[model samples]
Target: MAARRPARAAAANGEVRTGGSGRSDRRAELLRIAAGLFATRGYKQTTVRDIADEAGILSGSLYHHFSSKEEMLDEILRDFLGRLLERFTAIEEQGRDPKQVLDQLIEHSFATIHETPEAVALYQNESGALSGQPGFAYVDQLGRKIEEIWIRALTAGQKSGVFRDDVDAGMTYRFIRDTVWCAVRWYRPRGRFRHEAVAEQYLRVLYGGLVTE
Candidate 1:
């Protein structure tokens, strides 16, 4: 399912309503707090009260924005994966060649880890378990869709002689995907190497083999 945007609640005066923006901002903040807790504590271990306490609000007050903890989890995953897929799709569409497409994919992925480490960690740790759960069909669906985009780029590269043809595209894709996404565990936003630098170094090693030619 698509992520639902928070609607502006109408006031009795119908003057676009007071505090609408504040409520939306609060809702986003609550999601961020919940995502961090969920990433570190495990989803099943995190309680609604934990999120509320972190947000400095009463449990009941949290309900004013999100109906339940599950709702918040769903929204977080949906937004994260939805935006990721959208950006990747755009890169593929606009890229001039298969190599260029793959390059941007790797770069954007590192950027995502830098910008939203919690969301990246949460998805990496939880997605496999959530794939078969009810109401999480989109997890698998969108995941496969994202995987296909990468595979397309890799296979196209091989076909066009831009990449080695003997290597299995599926295996190559898995190697690159795991190597890129798993960096979330150790990557730090304030680390000596920024996301762009990390991407550049990775791409250098990836395209230019260590063995002297």
Candidate 2:
């Protein structure tokens, strides 16, 4: 599934939205350029000048949209994680059986990896160090909330006999979480297997043991 882009042009709290079409498009384009650079180059290594150079704009023009490179990073991560958390929370709230919920969650994750590999990679790369940094504590808090949803589903499945009771829920959750998210390392968006195919095969292996009866 293609990742949805947030509308960065809108204003809340009675703040007026002002920008011509050209400026808005350029702003979005600059963000795209920045995200790509941040994902490919480490965020700290990527300077505002780098972003401006990639966008073919001067640093002054780049600053007109974002106060600093940190602002750009914050906007990218915030939007990426915010959208991800919202989707996962919605899946949890649908009240499906644990197995179904887990299936959807796993599938959605693969799709996310396919659609927003850059964002996924960025989070994986920067989140640990950012945890101790001020103003970025929400990174860890949001991560914990996401972890809880997955663990809850796993526990529910175990209790309902749909999953094994032998494994600890927390450990199992960590294993599954790492396995799914780490695919961003090698997963190519245009690879031979599409995200849906990858998800289906993974689910097959997950639900059925490797040993054939």
Cα TM-score of candidate 1: 0.91
Q: What TM value does model 2 have?
A: 0.89
List the candidate 2 regions with Cα displacement exceeding 4 Å: 1-16, 20-22
* Candidate 1 local distance difference test against the native: 0.88
* Candidate 1 residue 36 C-alpha distance from true site, Å: 0.5
In model 1, residue pairs whose N, Cα or C atoms come closer than 3 Å (at least 3 residues apart or on different chains), thus clashing, are none
- The best candidate in terms of lDDT: 1
Query: Which residue window of length 10 is worst by lDDT in model 2?
Result: 6-15
Write candidate 2's Cα lDDT for 1-213 as tens digits.
113323442231012346566666666677678878888898999998999988888889886776678767776677777787888888988957999889999999999999888889888888987987966766777788888888999999999999899999999888888999999999988889999999999999888869899
lDDT tens string, model 1, 176-205? 999999999999899999999999999999
TM-scores for every candidate against the unseen true structure = 0.91, 0.89
Give the whole-model CA lDDT for all candidates, comma-separated: 0.88, 0.80
Off by over 4 Å in 1: 1-19
